[model samples]
Structures are given as structure tokens and as C-alpha cells.
Target chain A: MSEKHHIIQVWFFVGVLLLVYGFLILASGLAEWSHPPDIVLAELHAPVWWGALMLVLGLIYCIKFLPDRKA
Target chain B: MTAMMAWTVPTTLVHLSAVDLGIIAFYFALVLGIGFYLKRFANTGEDFFLAGREMTAWVAGLAFVSANLGSLELLGWAGSAYQYGILAAHWYWIGAIPAMVFLGIVMMPFYYISKTHSVPGYLQLRYGSATSALSAVTFAIMTILMSGVNMYAMAVVMKVVLGWNINFSIWVSSLTVGIYVASGGLFSAIFNEVLQFFLIWFGALLIPILGLIETGGWKGMVARIQQNFPGQDYTHAWSTLGRFQDNPMGMHWTGIVFGLGAVQAMGYWTTDFLVVQRVLSAKDIRSAKMAPIIGSFFKMAVPLIVILPGLLGLAVLPMHLVPASSLQPGQYSYNEVLPLMLARYCGPGLLGLGITALVAGFMAGMAGNVSAFATVWTYDIYRPFLRKTAPDQHYVSMGRWCTLIGLIVSIGTAYLAMGFASIMDYVQALFGFFIAPLFGTVLLGMLWKRVSRAAGFCGLLAGTLSSVTMFTLMKLDHRWVAIFALSPKAQGLAQDMYQALWACVTCVVVTVLVTLVTKPRPDEELKGLVYALTEVAQEGHTSFLHRPLFWGITALVILAVLQIIFW
Candidate 1:
């Protein structure tokens, strides 16, 4: 693929990632508003779980969109 | 004459035997020596402002932790833990870790790529010069107010614990900091911060380990707390999983978690030049990235050292000693309660000296702020506008002069802060008034591509207005007589949670919606930001997964869950 095409693809992936995380934040807010199951709320609030999820998603997004090794 | 005489009384001790005077003079000489020793490294503007961007990860990391662990946090958290039970740990667990992670992984790359000496510099690149100048001025004002209060708190502790007069303490503390900071610039500030990191950690740890042992160990302390404050909800309160309603003292868990936690976390971790200067001064991107994350490891343990002792103090000390009456009406002064505990419990000799070192630790934190304020004002605001062309030495000299001026202004601010009834209230009010608006602008500038310069500036103004309006309403409504009498239990909790809830909701909603409606910035400027974000992954040597984002989120979730269950 051409360099221009690659840059566009990277932008597309970033857009997706932002959307997904924004959705998660919205979900978390709504979940709190709706007062979800006690177990779910408990899990949702844990820094470990939320931190892990955000990290995993962020890493995957960064790696996929902005690869370390130049082709 | 009585008040004037009261001030001079503390100065009399300065004329005491040569030995006592020597110790004070020795302290001054040592600090100045460090400043002068580091002066060679600060020959340039970059070095003076940012240590020539050569600080190692470990130094940056430790300095970051030390700078944030001010006396206010040490004293405030302890008081909070004493009043609210263990659930107060959520402040560190839920608030600090996630914020640091977000800052490191997501926000920091923008800073690294922009290569801005100040956060406002980044604003200029991404938005426009107008927004940048506005932000620089706003931040300087906020730093002056916040650092002033922090300085005042340290002076207050010295006055209460050592029986020194307040004005004398302020003068001594301010001058000691001014001399080193003005001479050394960021170099001395970072060096002193490293020393203070150890001092604060050692001082904070000494209180709890010694206090617990004195009270018969953790089990004995726990038993005493349970016995005295039965059904006080220690388990839920201490746990990381608890909600806003979980705190018995009625501190709004959500408001603190989000408002102070998320908002102030964004302000301090992302925007504040003081914290950002540490990262910007790093040897490389990897060091900058790793420093705050590693620093957070220390921050995670700070509550154990600082807050736990206050909770332990509740069990060991008398009710009158840690009396609720000491707190001003409609205000919480829990931060003051810790030093009071030290004066009562910790005997003189090495133990007293160690606690005195803790007071120094707090001073070190305030000194770091003074150094940062001077650096930002001198390099970003003053030099840019006033003296556009100058040699590196000239800028460095100006930085030193700015440091002295900054210290004097902050000392005056601290004296004024004394009029406010509660330390935490004054600190929070200042933060909310100034930073809440800036948070919106910076956050939008970083994340949203579509936010225009006009919108960014407008959103900032709107967020500030919203925050001030909410704060005013809360203050006014709090004064009106209640229609019906509520139990003391209900009243306390309501008051604790109210301010945090209003501030968070108002700031977030106003900033986001306003930015969305406003036009986007010119595409050319934003394109660079986009390219930089994409390139950031390639620039840093460390693996992406090793980023603190994963660990931070996990920790935040675990702590939040624990807080909820415990609450």
C-alpha cells in the first residue's frame, strides 16, 4: 500500500478507538445512573480492571495505528 | 502592641546561644550551597527552566512524588481518615492512580511531541497565541494562590508545634526557599525535591509505624478504633470500592473521585507546569513517560504513611485532643489535626526532629511550586513578551530573579489565606475558581480535533463561569436555615458530598457541549498534532503495553471495587 493510504488507515483505526473508549465512558456513566447490579458496579469501579482495559485498548490501538517498526 | 510584640517574640529565639543560631545558619548555608553548586548546570534558559532536559527517570520520578505530597495532603488526608474511617483511602486508590495513568499514556505524548516548555506553549501550537497567553496568565495566578496556601499551612504547623510566631515562621520559611530557588532555578528544585522525597517518606512512615507500635500494633489500633467508634463503618470506609454515600463523614465520594480526582488530577498531572516541568526536563521521552508512573507507585503508598496514622491517632489520643470543635463551622480542617497529634503523642528528641523533618518535607513541596512558578513566568510569559532577544545567561539570571519575586508573592498570599477558616476549603476554592476553566480548554485541545481556537477560549470562559456560579450557589444555599431538623449524621454527609458533586457536573458538561458547538481550529495546525500523536508510538523506546495505562486502569478498578464493597 502507498504511504498516503497507510496514513489514512491509521486515522481510521484511531477514530474507531476513540469511539470505543468514549462509548465505554458513556456506558460507565449510564451504568452508574441506572444503578447496575452490585457485583457489576463493584467491578466497574475497580481501578485495576478499568485501568487494565484502558491500557490494553490503548496499547492495541497505538501499536496497530502507529507501528514501532517501519515497514 | 500586643500583636506586634507577639510577632517579635519568635525572633528573640534567633538571638539565643550561638549553637542554636549556628544550626539555623547552617541550614541556610547548606541550601544555598546546593543552589550555587547546581548553578553551572543552569547557564542556559533551558537548563534554568527545565534542568536542560537532562534529569534521569529516577530523579524525575522521586521529585514528582515529593512535590505532590505537600503538608496539606499529609495533614488533610490524615484528618479525613480520622473523621471518615478507612474509606478515605479511596482518595489515593481511586483518584491518584488512574489519573496518573491517563496522564502518562494518553496525555503525556502530546506534551512530548509538542516539545513545549510550558503547557501554555502547547496551547499556542494547537490553538492560538491568545489562548496560550491567557492560559499562562491563568496558571501563574492559580499557582500563586495555591502555593501561598501551602506555604501558610507549613508556617501554621511550625507555629502550633514549635510555638513559633506565625509571621516569623512565614518569613523564615519563605526566605530559606527563596535563596535556593532563586540561585539554582529548576536544578536546585529537583535536587531538593529528591532529598524531600526521602525525608517526607521517612517522616510520614515514622509516624504510623511508631504510633501503631506505641498503641500496641495494627490489631490493637484497629480494636481501639472499633471499640471507640462502633459501627462507624471502618471497613467500607477504608475499602477502595466504596461509593460517595459510603463515607460517614459525608465527603462526596463521587465528587472527590471525579471532581477533585478527575478534574484536579487533570490539572496537576496534565497541565500544571510544575509537574510537567519535571517530565519535560527528563533525559528522553522514555524517562518522562516512566517518571510519573513510577512516582505514582510512591503516591499509592503515601496514604498508608500519612492517613493511617491520623486514623490511628483517633484511637490513641483523647476526643478533646482531636476534637470536632476545632474545625470551623461549614469547614473541615482535618489537615491541621495531624500536627496536633504529633505535638501531643510524639515526644521530643529524635522523634520530634523526625517530625520536624516532615514539616521540612512540606516546605520542600511548597518550594518546588515556587521554583516552577518562577520558571514559567520568566521563560514563557516574561521573556516571550518583555525581552524577546537575550542571551541564555540573561534568561537564566532573570529566572533566578523571578524565583525571589515569586517566593515573596506566595508568602504574602499565604498570610492572606490564614483568614479563611479551613485550609482545604481555601485550597479547593482557589483551584475550582482558576483551574476548572483551564481544564476544559486543555483537555479539548488535546483530544478533540474539531475544537476551534475561538471555541477553546470560549469553553474555558464558560467552564470558569459555570464553576464560579455553582460554587456561589453552594455557599449561599449552605447558609440558609434548613426547613426541618435532620439528624447530625444526615447533615454532615450531605455537606461533605455537595460541593464536589456540583463542581464536577458543571465543569464537564459545560466544557464538552460548548466545544462541540464551536467551530474547529484551522486544519493545518491540527494536522501536526495528529501526525505527532501517530509518531509518538515510534519515538519512545519502551514497549507500548508496558505503559502505565494498563496497570493504572487495573489498579483504579480494583480500588474502586474495594471502596464500593467496603462503603
Candidate 2:
């Protein structure tokens, strides 16, 4: 593939990853909605660990696939 | 209790006079000295306003921390801890770290990529001059409102601590900041901020330490809290999710974590020129990028300095000593609690002056905000439209003039804002209403190639209007409920989180959808657009969107996980 096309694909992939991550959060919140964590854990509110994992995966994709400046 | 053991209020002004004056003089001399020392740097517009873009990351980092660490926070956070238990920390955990990292890694890169002198200048390059002007005007108005509130906070602190007339306190605090800012512009502002940061840190730490010792140490204090406030969950008190309803002290984790953390984070870290100006004024992209990261690390430690003391005060003092009204339901002005504690507890000696330094710490924060407003107006607004080709010296002179104008405007605004609940609350709510939506437009314009200027402008207008509509509706609903004798808690969680969630979502959706419909700009205009991102290049990266992108993303994930586990 051409360079421009490759760059476009990378961005598209990253967008998909973010969308998935958002969905995961929505699901977790739904699962926990009825039985809210105790006040201690409730203050945590969202699933930060899952969020962190998704963020990490997204970062890895960016590192491997995203374009760098050409000298 | 024996008469000798009973607490007695100081009956004579003579006891407080020397220490109070000494504190005032110390503050005046330090700020003024900074202003004078940096006078030569203010010989030109760039130097006066942007520090000639020569600031290192460390300087920018320190200044950024100092700018945000105002008295409101010093007072508010401590009040929060005392009232809410540990859950109050949710404010710092949820809102601060994530938001700041987003700014440093994501937004800062965009600014560096744009190579714009000011945040509004980036808007101009991406959208058009009109949009840029609108953003600048919006920021200026919001900043004025904010600085006014900050001024009020300083005035109130001074009034309560020293018994000065409110008007006199406002003038003295506002004018002292104005004089230095007017004298040396950003240079003096930064220099003074560095000094203020140290003073604020010292003062914030000292009060809690002293109070803890006086209360018979941690064990005694903990026992007192347990005995006095029964059924109070210790874990919840320290938990990040603690809500205001949970604490008799009137602070809620929801407001601190979500409201202050998410909303304030987006507003201040992303949009506020005062903080962003520190990064923009850096000598290069690397320094700019590093500033917020380092500054945020420093911000993380502030709880130790500010919050612990308030908690300590709550433990040591009797209910009779602290009036019931002061700790009334839903009326904890965390800011007032500190000075009140000091007045009640501090004895005649050097320790008294040290506590006075906490007041100075508060003043320093106010000064930073004042100077920031001055810089934004002078460089982004005045110089652009009023005098296009003015000499450097003339621009520098204008900067000083602008600083004076900012101070005067802020003082007037501060006096007007006092009737509102808490200054910090008012400022944060106002910022959410005004500035948060703008972040969406700016972020899209920088990252996406298809986002047109017209689309960006339309998106901004739509996002802002929608967010405001939602906010108004929520307020109206709350008011109606109150009229019907309904409790605030009955209004529901959605109403509370409405402003932050919708404001962020609306801005993103509007910008994206509008961009999809609009035609992209011509290729020629887009040539240099990507260069700003490229100039701050990673050596090992083979393309524009390489390792740094992933590194930033990975960092976000780690942060999220940590938040989940610890928070």
C-alpha cells in the first residue's frame, strides 16, 4: 500500500479501538448498575483497570502502526 | 473542664498586630522584588508577555503548579477532607491526573504542532479569524469572572484572618498583584509564582503539622473524630467516591472528583490561557510537553500540605468552639475553616507568622491568575486588533497597561461575586459553562484533516449552546423541586453529572458531524498545518504517527488501571 493509505488505515484502527473501549466501559457500568459497589468502591465509580488496559492496547497500536516524521 | 484548660478567644488586637503586619510586608516585598527583578525582560512584547518563549520545562512546570494552587484550593480541599472523610480524594484521582495527562500528551502536542503563540491563535489557524476572536473574547470574559472570584477568595481570607474591612482587603490584595504584574508582565508573574509556590507549600504543610501536634497527635485526633461523629466510615472519608451527602461537613466527593476533577480539569488544563501560557512560553516543544507532566506530579502532593490540616482542625476543636453555623448542613466553606482554626489555635510566636504565610500562599495563587488574564488580553486580543505593527517596546508597555486593567476589572468583579455561594464553586461552574466546549473544537481541528473552519465554528457554537441549555434546564428543575419542598438529593445523579458529560460529548459529536458535511480546505493552506506536529519529532519514529502516539496511549491505560485499583 502507498504511504498515505497506510497512515489512514492506522488512524481508522485507532478509532475502532477507542470505540471498543468505550463500549466496554458502558457494559461494565451496566453490569454493576444494580449492585453498586459499597461506598468505598462506589467512589471508584468506573472500571479504571479495564479503562487502563484498553488505553495501553491503544497506545501499543499507535506505537507500531502510526506514522513518524521523515527526515 | 478547668478554667486554665478552657479555650479563650484573644481579646486584644495587640497580640495579632505585629505578626499580621509582618506577614503582609513579607508578601508585598517578595512579589514586588520579583516584579522589579524581571523588569528588563519586559522591554519587549514577547519577553513581557510570553517570556520571549525562553522558559525551560522546569520553570514552566513550577509556574503552572503555582498558578493553580490558589487559596480557594488550599481552603476548599482541606474543608473537603474534614467534612467528607477520605472519599474527598476522588477529586484529585479521577479528575486531575487523567485530565492533566490528556493535556500534556494529547493537547500539548497539538499546540506545539500548530506553532501558535496563543491558544486563540491556534483557533484562528484552524477555523478562521472570527472564530479565533470569539474564542479569545469568551476566554477573556470567563477569565475576568474567574479572577474576580479568586480576588473575592483572597479578600475573604484576609478579612476573616486579620479583621480588615472587606473592601480594603479586596483592594490591597488586588492592587499588590496588579502592581507587580503591571511592572514586569509574565516575567514578574512567573518569578513571583515560583516564590509563591514555595510559600504555599510550606504554609500548607505547617498548619496541619502544628494542629496535629496540638490535638495530641494522630491517635488522639482519630479518637475525637470517631467519638464526635459516630457512624462516620473512615474508609469512605478517605475514598475518592465520597459524596457531599455522606459528610456532615458538607463537602461531597461527587463535586470534587467529577465537578472539580473532570470539569475543572478540562477547563483549566485545556483552555485556560494562564496555565497554557506557561507551556506556550517554553523555548521548545520538549520543554512545553514536560511542563504539565512535572507540574501535575507536584499537584498530586498538595493534599498532604492543604487537606490534612483541615482534618486535624476538625479533630482537635470542640463543637462549641466551632459554631454550628460554620459547619452547617451543605454550607461548609472549606476556605473559611483554615483561618478560623488558625485564629483559634495559633499562639503568639514564630508559628503564628508561619500560619500567616498560608495566607500569603493564598495571595500568590490570586496573583498568578491576575497576571495570566493580563498576558492573554495584552498579547492575543489587544496587540492583534489594536496595533498590528507596534514596536516591541510599545507592546511591552501595553502589557503593563493590560496587567493594570486586568487587576482593576478582577477587583470589581470579585466584589460583585461575593454574594454567590463559594468563590471556587462559582468559578468552576462558570468555567464548565464557558470553556469546556471549546476544547472539542480545538482538538478536532488539530487531529482531523477533514475538519473545515466553517464546520469547526458551527460545532463550537452548537456545543456551547447545547451545554448551556442543559445546564439551565438542570438548574430550573432544581429550583422547581425546591419550591415543591423536594430535597436536592431527589434531583438525581444525572442532573449532577449532566454538565461535564454532555459538554464533552456534545463538543466531540458536533465537531465530527459538522466536519463530515463540510469540504476540506485547499491543499496549499494545509501545507504547514502538519509541520507543527512534525517539528517536535521523535528520533526513532519512522512516521508522524509512530511510537509517541502509542506511548501516550499506553500511559493513559496504566493511569486508568491505577485509578481503578487505588481509587
Candidate 3:
């Protein structure tokens, strides 16, 4: 038999956290890019690309097993 | 964000508004809640100590590096960046990645499948009781002392950044870490550490980003630093590393590669129990192996959080703004870079979040150390010495007790760690004295089954004695380290690295020579302990692309590219 202990096992709390955090960070980046403010968003040199990266990873993680919850 | 109260460390404060205090309070409560909430999973000794052996690679991975990635790391190494420039990246790259990847690729099979609780427990199985006891005692002391150093770092950050009483900050931080760790054990500690890993990124992301933008990005920042520091090229890593005297830091290339990169890095990452215990708490053998691999990836990126701020500070903060205490006759307290950046860049809500990130780092660090101390004290020492056949419940109780004792001892030790020029260097010196010899001993014990119990014990004993003796000699007179460096300034860090390298050599030499003379342990006795004798439990089973070996190789390749690019 093949053996690969994938870390894709169901996570109870962490999964939800990833989903919320990912969505928030990803959305924040998108929002910032789309609607740049004169002053509120000024002085903010935040790494939106990094946030997108975090979001993609987070989405992949959450989407992989979010629907497959175990009792 | 700027409280223009004639800013000075210990006296000057961030003058946190209500929002900042609220965020910090909420963060502390959340951490404690997570700890107490996990008490259900920690009923048994295994659950309490090893998180029921169910740590996912991601969780364990983050916790693995986060254990060391505290304010001490972010603040101390950022200070290194401010003083030494991009060469500080070596600590994260060559100093950590190779050894960490090696642990995942080579050592984890033995560390995981054999099912040892602590590093000393592994030693006991391989080299017998005396060696294990010595390791356990030394490790326990190291963990407590290191935990104390974390405590001191937390206090200093508070005193400098927020202008709090150092003693009050230390006591409060210790109580918070002590409460969670004593209640939930490793489960709480690892969970909190993983949380902290994210928080630190969230908190400190602003400085480097804003600082770079402020200076007109990478090229601009480099130009600024060059202007500020006339002959020093702070942007490059490997180019300046060709010679110690060539660099502003007066460090040699040989010491960087051999002493810091090989011995000190391998010693701490591979052998030290603080980080190892996090990996051991992983869900399974493969996860244990994968944990450090994943940590290795983050470890590569971590310099961004810790080091970038320092570089940013170099290009941004004026020389006069640096505190008089931190600034010497010529040398500036580069240690103030992180605090200075935090104070200058972050505003209101973000400022509180940044402050919490650092506080969380210290808290996580204290928890990591206390948890490690408890495990060694319980598994390696108490179980073997106090009551050999005690109930698992009793051992868990002992672990909790040790957690309290460890935190208390650390408070005392934190007092000792103060006044050092760089917390990073002071910690490196500590690592050299203990970790360098231990790695030498463990390296021989694992790979060569011929290493006898007596040989291991005596080799470790002798190597340790030599490390202390060398330190004493160097402290007493410059004549002791005359061979290593011509001047006292060059002797600063180069001496520690050389001493570690020589001590490691001494341990290896002594262990080898002694093992050759002494009767060897039978192959049967070394059945899962020695590399040659042990069956690779999870080898060739993992998907080649997904396996730790694959990821470890991938990390090394990335590291090489980064080094060359930065060079």
C-alpha cells in the first residue's frame, strides 16, 4: 500500500480561523487597490501581494477540507 | 503616534492611548482563553506533554520556529541588522535552514519513530543514563535561563517602547505565560505559539513596508544607508561576508560559515530541546518530519519581520534619535531599531497591534521554554530519578509543578541577562557553551553505534568543561583569545564562534578516541537508536514531491538563490 501522511486531516478551530482570516486579508487588499483614499490609505505601504498570497494559501487550506467535517 | 516628550528609552514612552491598551488586553485574554479551553485535551501525561501526538505539520511547523521567533528574535536580530547589515540574514539562512532541513531529512526519522519524549530521552536510549542525566540537567537549566532571557527581553521592550516599570512588566508577562502553560501544558503552548506566529507577521508588517516606501523602496533605502554609513555596504550579504575585516562588523567569513553556521546553528536547531519538543508534539512520524520542513520555509522568510525593520531604521531614524545608553562612544544601540520603528511608523490601533505582537512574542517564547523545561524535568529527570514507576498522572502533575518552578527561576535569570550589548550575541554565547558540545555528543551517538556510554559521558563532560574554561580565560585576559583575533573589537563575536567550533571538535575527538578504546554497544542494543541499525519507519512511503526530503531540498535551493541574490 502507498503511504503518504498528508496533513490535510480535518482541523476543527483552525479551519474556520483560516477561512475568516484569509477572506479578510484578501478582501482588504482588493478593497485597498480598488478604492484608494487620499489620506486614510495614504502612508499605508502594506504588502497587499503578501496578503493575497496568504489568502490563496488560506483559501486552499479551508476549501480543501472545509466541506469535509468529521464527527 | 508620536508623543513628542523628548523620546528616550526607559524614560520616553509610546503613551499608549485607550485603543492600544484595549487591543493588548483583548489579546492577552484570547491567549489565556485558548490555553484554558484546551485543558480538555490534556488530561493524560501524553496529552499534556505531546498534545496527544496529534500536531498537524502546519501547526507544529509554525510552533516549531515560533518557539524561537519571539520579541528576542524580532528585536534582537533586527538590532543585528541595524549594526551588521544584511549579514544578519545568515542567522536565518545558513545558520538555521541547513541544520533545520538536516533535522527533517536525516534526524527526524530517529527522533520521531523511536518515540522519545525529550532530546535527553533520546540520549538515554542511545548513550545510557549518565549521559542522558547530564543532558537533561544541562537542558533544564538552559531552558529556564533562556526563558528568563525572554522575560528580560519582554521587560526591556516594555520599558523602552512603552515606558513601563521593568519589574512590573517581567512579573506580569511571567504570570500570563505561567498561567496558560501550567494549565494546558504543551497543547496550550503550541497552539498559542502558532497564533503568535501569525500575529507577529500582522503586527510588524507595517514597518518594513512603510519604511521602504518612505525611502522610495529597496534601491532608495540602500542609497540612504550608503549615504548614512559612508563606506559600509549594508545591502549585500555574501559579498561583504568574504572577509570579516572587510565588513563594518569586523567579523571573518570563516567564523560565519564554520563557527556560527555549522556548529552553533546545528547545535541549537538540531540538538536543543526547546524547538525539538514542538516537533515531537506533531501528529505522527511524517508530520514530525514535516514540521521542521515547513518551519524551514517560514524560517527563510522570518528575516523580513526581524531584519527588514533594522535596515529600515538604518535608512530612516536619525543618529541623534538613538538613546544615549544604547549608543556607545562610536557604536549605536542597533537593538533599539525595532522599538524605534514601532514607535515611529505605527499609529493608534495599528500601534497597539504592533505592541501586542511583540508582547505575544515574548509570551510565546516564555511558554516554549517553560514547556520544554517541564518535559525534560518530568520525562528525563523526574521519572528516571524521583519515582521510576510512577503513574502517568503523577508525571503530568510533576510537569505542571516544574512549569511553575521554571518560570520562577527564569524571572531570576532574566535579571542576569540584562546589560548585554546585544541579546542575540549574549544568547549565542550561552548556546555555544551548552549546545555546541551536546550536538557533538548527539551527532556521534546517533550515527556511530560504537560510541560507548562512558565515552559519551566523558566526552560531553570534557567538552563542556573546556567551553566554560575557555570563556573564563577569555573574560580574565585578552591573552586567552589572542590566537583568534588581534584586537578586542574583533574578539567580540568571533571568539564565541571559534570557541564553539573548537569545543565541538574537542567533543568529537574525545568521543571518537574514547569509543575506539571502550567496548562498543551491541547492534541489538542500538536497534532503533543508531542510524545504521534502525529501520527507516516512514522512508520511501511519502510522495516524493511531498516528503520532508523534497521540501527540505526545495528550501535549501530557495535559500541558495536568496543568498546569491542578496550577496
Native A-B interface contacts kept, per candidate: 0.00, 0.00, 0.00
Deviation in Å, model 3, residue B222 alpha carbon: 1.4
lDDT of 1 by residue, A1-71 (tens): 11211112222233333333333433443444444322212323332233244346545655565643554
Candidate 2, residues B481-547: lDDT per residue as tens digits? 2322123542222233346546756777877888788888875675445333334556464553433
For all the predictions, what are the DockQ values?
A: 0.01, 0.01, 0.11
User: Which structure is stronger by lDDT: 1 or 3?
Assistant: 3
In terms of docking quality, model 2 is: incorrect
Candidate that would win on DockQ = 3
- The CAPRI classification for model 1 reads as incorrect
Model 2 residue B369 CA deviation in Å: 2.7
How far off is residue B6 in model 3, in Å? Answer: 18
TM-score of each: 0.76, 0.75, 0.89
lDDT of 1 by residue, B265-384 (tens): 566566777777887877777677777877777777787776687777667765523333455443325555676555543322222333444556656766778777777677668877
Query: Would you list the clashing residue pairs of candidate 3?
Result: B55-B283, B244-B251, B244-B252
Q: Write the per-residue lDDT of candidate 3 for residues B82-194, one digit (tens) a residue.
A: 87788788889999999999888788888886799889999999888899999999888888788878887787777677777677777777888888998889888987887
Output DockQ, candidate 3.
0.11
